[model samples]
Target: MFTKILIANRGEIAVRVMRTARRMGIATVAVYSDADAHAMHVALADEAAHIGPAPAAESYLDGERIIAAAKATGAEAIHPGYGFLSENPDFAEAVEKAGLVFIGPSPRSIRALGLKDSAKQIMEKAGVPVVPGYHGDAQALVVLATKAREIGYPVLIKARAGGGGRGMRRVDHPDEFADALAAARREARTAFGDDRVIVEKLIEKPRHIEVQVFGDRHGNVVHLFERDCSAQRRHQKVIEEAPAPGMTAAMRMAMTQAAVKAAQAIGYHGAGTVEFIVDAAKGLKPDRFWFMEMNTRLQVEHPVTEMVTGIDLVEWQIRVAAGEALPLSQNEIGLSGHAVEARIYAEDPACDFLPATGTLHHLRFPQPIPGVTLRVETGVRQGDIISAHYDPMIAKLVVHARDRKAALSALASVLEETEIAGVAVNTAFLARLVQNSDFVAGKLNTRLIPRHQQALTSFPEPETRTMATAALAASGAKFAPDAPDPFDAISAYAHFHPITHRRAIRHGDRTRYYAITGLGDGRFAVRSEEENAETLVLPAEYGERIVPWPGHLTIFDGPDNHTFQLHDPLEQAGLAASGSESLRAPMPGLVKLVRVAPGDKVKKGQPLLVLEAMKMEHTVCAPHDGVIAETVAEGARVNDGTVLVRFAESNTPNAGRPARRNIEPSRL
Candidate 1:
């Protein structure tokens, strides 16, 4: 084995590759940009090199800089983790010319499969079935339009250069072909520097199934089963599972053999995935699957296959690059339990799935459960910033179970417990997806997410108990359905035997006040708008999580997750105040003590009240010497601009202002 290797990519994959390299006693080098200086991958590598700035063009994609970094670090090989320069044939050839190993397929193989058009042509010549379409190299838009006409309506205009649904457009009718072709070309050129495209007969109900194929220098190859990536949004995979549900022995044989044949024809070496589009309308059939394309490197969803087969693909990649023979034959590899992987992205599912960028102020992954293995592959920590310059993938959560049903159930529960703050995520969306009737029943397709957009993308409204849970979680308490509730500390001794905490929580377009009367033993009587007080009890099977931060709180009740803007009475009172600044709160914190009462004369700069946050004391002072017109209750939790006290003046502008007023949202 080589003494060391350099990973020329960032994020989870780079971290993933280094781990296997380390296990095999190989020291690894990492190359990073300014944006990834403190990235988790950088910290994990044995030796690191700074390539360039944040922009990929100036950094990760600059092959020369990467080669230089490897040479300077005395590394013997470079592993291009997927996405950036992973499938670039020239870069692979450059690595070989520089006397360093490229831990992937040879540059020749990449060249044969790099472009969708040429790859499809080669597949046809190799006797591997391909989707019927025009794979010719004609650049004229008129020519492409002609091919689209011949292929019939509903032809797909796909970017011949790269994948990820970019540079691809689905033209449902001839009238939409010209405009779609233009848009696809523009996207392709901007994304891959190649505007070339291919017209493929669109499979109406397509299931994206790809087989994991491996080859070595000795001309031997083996298949590691398949992964179903049919759960997608805009052609980008969201959930992927191994041993595709409902795969029969005959169909598996045909698809796996075809994948191997495609890889073998390219004179392939190392790891490669042959992706096929299956016509799911008629179910899996030997003749219904056709080759879509081949990925020249490790896939983001490789973990699912690894979980099912107990093979480390990265190890295989390194071994094959080191000229080792194939580890196992086709029959030697066996699939075990089913495994599924869900991509945890830093994006909002509600807002067109737009990418979100922010510091991961709070990030927590699900813990392993009985009879299931949970793996979280990530390169970000709690404080890491999700930058706008790169793909906004936070992590990949993989789980393995005895069967597909158990695996799906565990995944849903785990997703429900996932807590992420500061950036919107698809945690809730993915949770609902796994439990979706069609998905759980094994009815999947590329259009699954798009077809069920309304149901999957929409977050369910939280119940009154959920709001009560949010309040309790914010106060630093956790409740398990079966565990005895030990919440006496929050209960107050008054004329009554119990204490009720009333607070207003604003979620979505509505703000409702909840009354949570503690009844002891982790139970409460809760009431919300237009609802009577009901005994709140979480089912023995729990699907609840609460994450609280400054001025905000998030509650997850099974399939429901929502962030509430906590409304303090102080804030409601402060908003109506136009008389003095003292009525406004300085920050979100607890009102520790109120020194003066209403009508009390105070001197300018005198300490009014003590507010506490982060274990520190901050005293509110008098804005000017004046008589106090009103004072908020002591020991109240308040947000910024929450009215603390009002000064009596000629301009008692908001003394009688109603506490609740119609609040209009800012135009987005």
Candidate 2:
């Protein structure tokens, strides 16, 4: 193994690579931007270097700065963790030319697969089952549209240089083709600096199954089975699992062979993933799959593969980079158990899934259960701001169990017990999805999120009875001073002792009264006059209370607590502030373009502004058919909920529809 290596990335993946390097007795050099000066990855590394400013283009993507940092720290090799410069062939070649090892596949191999158009042709030559698409070099829109017609409707317009779902669009029909193509090209140009696109036939009910393959300089390559990443949102993976459910022996063999062939064809070395889109409308088949693309580096979901195969892929990366052969043959590697990984992002699921930013005031995971370790890979800590300059991902939570059902159950419970504060997250949403009957049944596909949008986006709208009960319990505990504790009120009323305490609680559109009958040990039992009683329990870690009698509500724990927060029914409503005059930016970003001028009459839902953050463009629309009084100029920086514009009420009441609001969203 090398004595020292530099991580040319930030966030959790940098921390992840550093961890494995530490275990292997390799010192790690971490590079950070202005926003990540105090990042967890920097603290964990043996040494650190500042590359540039907060913007990725100035720092993480600055190949020269990263190379200089590596050389300054005496790192023998550079590990470009999955993003930024990971797939940049020029950077890889530069590293090698500087007499430093690029701990991944060579420059030639990356160049071969980095461009989607060329990679498809290569896959076709290798008989790896390329997706039926137009990978031609024609740049004309009419030509591309003609190719889309040949490929049929519901075609995917994908950027030739895209990954992570950026610069991709799905057109359902011919009418939407041109607009989608234009938007895709604009985003492709902005994201990848390439407006070229390829049209592909969109498979119905597709399951994203990717095989992990590793190669070394000795002409040795081995396949590490597959991971099912069908659970996705906006073309990005949400949940992933190893040894795909419902996979057959024949199908697995064919995929494994194809993956091996793809790697060997490019003389690939180190860890790589060959992703395939499986047509699941008719279930699994040996030939019913098409190549999606190859991730030319270690994947975010590699932990699932590691949990099942009991092999450290990072170790293999290091070994291969050190000029070693493959560690194990394909037959020798056996998948032990089912593993599932849930990406925990700092994002609001209810607010168009916009990325959220805040300091992590509190963060903790439930203790791991035996045989099921909950691994949290993160590069931030309490009090660390989740900067809008980078990915909203806070951590990756991975769990392993003997079976898929067991793993799913374990993940569900863990998600609920996870305590995060100071920032909104998708934890509750993830918990609900894992507990969904359809999800538990392995009824998965790319459309899973769309199919379950109602359940996933509709947060718990608890009934008044439940809300009142909780409020009374929380309020009673807060009001009582020396009472044997208001929590004791639950059991205080024996079947005969009739003492009822009234409390008002509001949930949704109605407010109702609840009579509390008992309270003890942070538990309260209450019932509406016409409903049955219900008991509630709040975790003790939040705080403890001891009341002698009723004086004034004395509180113990609540949202103010460090570790836990009661599920506030109005939290979502508060976050989704809608109405009236002002247009607020949904998250921190720079105003990219402004279309409406002051005093301009704008129609409801008309695009008035665009904000670029986290590598994506979000258009802000007019809140109503109103005269714009003010608008934020283009290229201005704004924070979450920052008022960018104000509008005069529309002259026509509820013109065409209810007043629409524009909330520019942040990227994830």
Candidate closest to the true structure, highest TM-score: 2
Candidate 2 has its poorest 10 consecutive residues by lDDT at: 554-563
Candidate 2 lDDT, tens digit per residue, 1-668? 79999999998899889888999999999999999998889999999999999988899999999999999999999999988899999999999998899999999989989999999999999889988989889989889888889899889999999598888989998889887887788677878878899899999889999999999999988999999999888788999999898999999999999999999889989999999999998889998998989989999999999999999998899899999888898789998889999998887777667777777766776789777867887778877888788888888889999999889989987887676766768887888777778778888788998798777877655444335434564444332324576443444545676355666544323445656654434444456654564544433223333211122122212111111223344753553344345766766788877888887988877888777777787777775577987888888998777767777663432222211134544223
Name the lDDT value of residue 519 in candidate 2: 48
279-387 in candidate 1: lDDT tens per residue?
Answer: 9898899999999999999999999999999999999999999999988887889999999999998766775565556678789887899999999999899989887
lDDT of each: 0.81, 0.79
**Which residue pairs show collisions in model 1?**
none
Task: Indicate the residue-level lDDT of 163 in model 2.
Answer: 90
Every model's TM-score: 0.78, 0.84
RMSD of each: 13.5, 6.3
| Residue 295 accuracy (lDDT) in model 1 | 90
Q: What TM-score does prediction 1 earn?
A: 0.78
